[model samples]
Target: MTDRDLTALLERATEDVVERDFAENAWAAALAARRHRRRTLLTGVGAVAVAALAVTAVQLGGADHPKPTPATSSTTSTTGGTLSDGTAYAVMPQEGTEGQLRDFDAGLPSTIDVRARAEAFSAARPPGSVVAVYLRADGDDLLHPVLVAGDGRHVLMGDVDLVRTTDASGNEATPLGPRAVGGGGRYVVFPQRDHVLRLDAQTGDTVSYPVPAQHVEWAGWNAAGTRIVARASEGAWSIDPSTSRAEAVPVVGGYEGTFRVTATDALPSDVRVTRFDEDGRPLMSTPVRGPTWSLWGETVNTETLAATGAFFDQNVTSKVIRRGYGPIYQGLLVVEPSSGAAKVLLAPENPDGQTGRVKGCCTVLGWADADTVLFQSLGSHGRWVLAWKTTTGEVFEVARITTSAPDDPVTPIALNVGRRS
Candidate 1:
């Protein structure tokens, strides 16, 4: 047969065998199906995870998509079993958040024995050595103060009012909140007009100490947790809760040993950090670039004179950032007080509040150890407590925290730097 005739015959045969090309459509449909199935499975898994957190008391984990290496909780519980892993930080639920969890039939107890809880927790860990001081919503305006150890043993302190009210002098006093926790985790303080109510976590005792000034607000504890500081209309004062002696002192930041660290606001191109002695003398000063706001909080390493910084934007003004900034930056920064060296340790891809990403990449909770800095991160699973080794730059998930309130997750409060073995 002629070559042209043979080709025509082959073409006719091909046309008769093949009707239409549905390969592209089939592939697209298959991809869509796979994605849908994946999403559904993840959702189911997430729901189960949430339920587990509610039932098990505190079973925490990281993102459902990118699975993180599970670590045990920093604490070793006596009654409760060991936590999944130790990337754990203290978290506070919003007022309505825990209430919503109860509404969802999470079986959360309405009333918990505050003293019994504290005693149980103290049995597992010692006083002044806590991992976290958090507020748990209890279907009221008052949030229950909880003392959580590294092993996940928690003590629920009775509720206290958080409503902002004007003192006798007509000055609006700051509302009592999670920040009222003492550095050692041995005590939790709240302002009550002319007096401060201090709760002892070990003995479940409450003491009221009179303040020299009216409308005093809790300013947290000194770096050593030995003295409780409060601010008033007149001035700031540091009180020795042991002796009930209150003395006026200059407002200092992160006080540790004989030194303290302070940073300027997010107004200029660089933040001026100053280190001061216990007597309010400037020892050293350094300028750190980046960090529009230091909302992530700072803690100083006394031995190295280095502090942790969480910045919203690098070298950006607060005014510009507030006006709807784009591609904003958020990460962990380490600043040295003596050498004036600032380094960005971990810079995550997406900014804060980005959809389909970690809620916040890193917020410095405090140093888990001398070398490991513990920070909190939020993802699809829940809030995760992560650890970063400054010496080796090794980062890993320490603990996963899924609160009873899944929709409105808990926010990490100050981390208890003390991790007992």
Candidate 2:
């Protein structure tokens, strides 16, 4: 069939079938039967005929037709009700009293009101013995404080220093060498200055290991206190404390993305670009610039992974890659950073849906584990409370820890980040 004839047949086939009718006469049937004509045209014209017809349709304003507006329902608000700050706030469970838990801005100074009465103690160290320290949180009881202090030398949790040795008096301080403060008040005082010290804050007991000072820098640690990323003067290394050995890996350069220590050794070999071969076969080409590293793990049982990369286009923006198990437990979950919002692309499992705005000018500060990510939301009063997200992209409440005594006045919660639409 000629090109014009095939085009007309295809166009008619795309229209409503009920709209077109024909008489029972043979010639009339032949003119009305576009389906039968299509089969004959497709068989004779081949692939080039299809491409030409598509191009013609686009040129004739066919492809530019507006799509039907999708139907949508009201968004069900999760835990926290929408606050006046343009951010959402929710109340989480606390071990203390019911009023002990309060909602505050994750991006600004907020007061943590505690009704319990308790005594507070402060720890002091001699000049050269300690370098620097900061407070983490202040609670009515002694456990949660807002201020956390640490130097490249030692980490102090509450009234105890992970690296310090006490005299006859009950005191602690860092002897100095290289030490890293892991979560849960645990410190890995490394194989430095001839000893590795593991001190128990509750009992004030210390366990010392004898090893050579191999030079240490802050390598990120996992929640289990097993997987740790440390950079020595030699190269990039990961030490699994559970196995008591270090493995050397290539230096992955770029924005520091969240890392996880897996139960098995499986990570993506490399990240490259999407390209086409000379014969037009699709392939992945080597990355021209930016970092090529796996953010998530590679094992079949692996639950989550996150990585950071830079855009090569005009804006030259930075972005993060997060892949996790989806809500329904089918495929992976992905999120991309674009302009002012995070574009979440669900894997094959989700039927392609997007999320509303997740407010704040934030940078991922740390990862609690494979399931939770902590982000530092920048706002007016310095760095405020951090924001955390579950593997399924669900956000928890904003927790504000106090830096002073428990009786001190609390600051107002700042909510500047807007919701996504």
Using all chains and alpha carbons, the TM-scores for the candidates as numbered come to 0.55, 0.31
Task: Please write out the lDDT profile of model 2 over residues 1-421, one tens digit for every residue.
Answer: 1233222222211100000011111110101111111111112111110000000000111112122110121111212222222211221111121112222222222222222222232334311111111222333212221121111122234443232222222222212211133333333232233334443323434455433234332233322334443333344334444444443333432001122111111222222322222121233322211211222211110022331111111111111111321121111112211111111211111112422111112223323333333332222222223333322233332333333352232221111111100
In model 2, the number of clashes is 28
Q: Which stretches of model 2 miss by more than 4 angstroms?
A: 1-197, 208-215, 219-229, 236-302, 307-372, 386-397, 401-421
- What is the Å distance of residue 155 in model 1 from its true position? 2.4
- The residue-level lDDT of candidate 1 at 23 comes to 18
How does model 2 score by TM-score? 0.31
lDDT of 1 by residue, 129-194 (tens): 343555545553344556654343565555443433244444432233223555345566665555
Tell me, what's the RMSD of every candidate?
A: 21.6, 26.8
Candidate 1 segments exceeding 4 Å error:
1-130, 149-152, 159-185, 190-196, 210-218, 232-234, 247-268, 279-284, 289-295, 298-302, 312-328, 349-354, 357-361, 405-409, 419-421
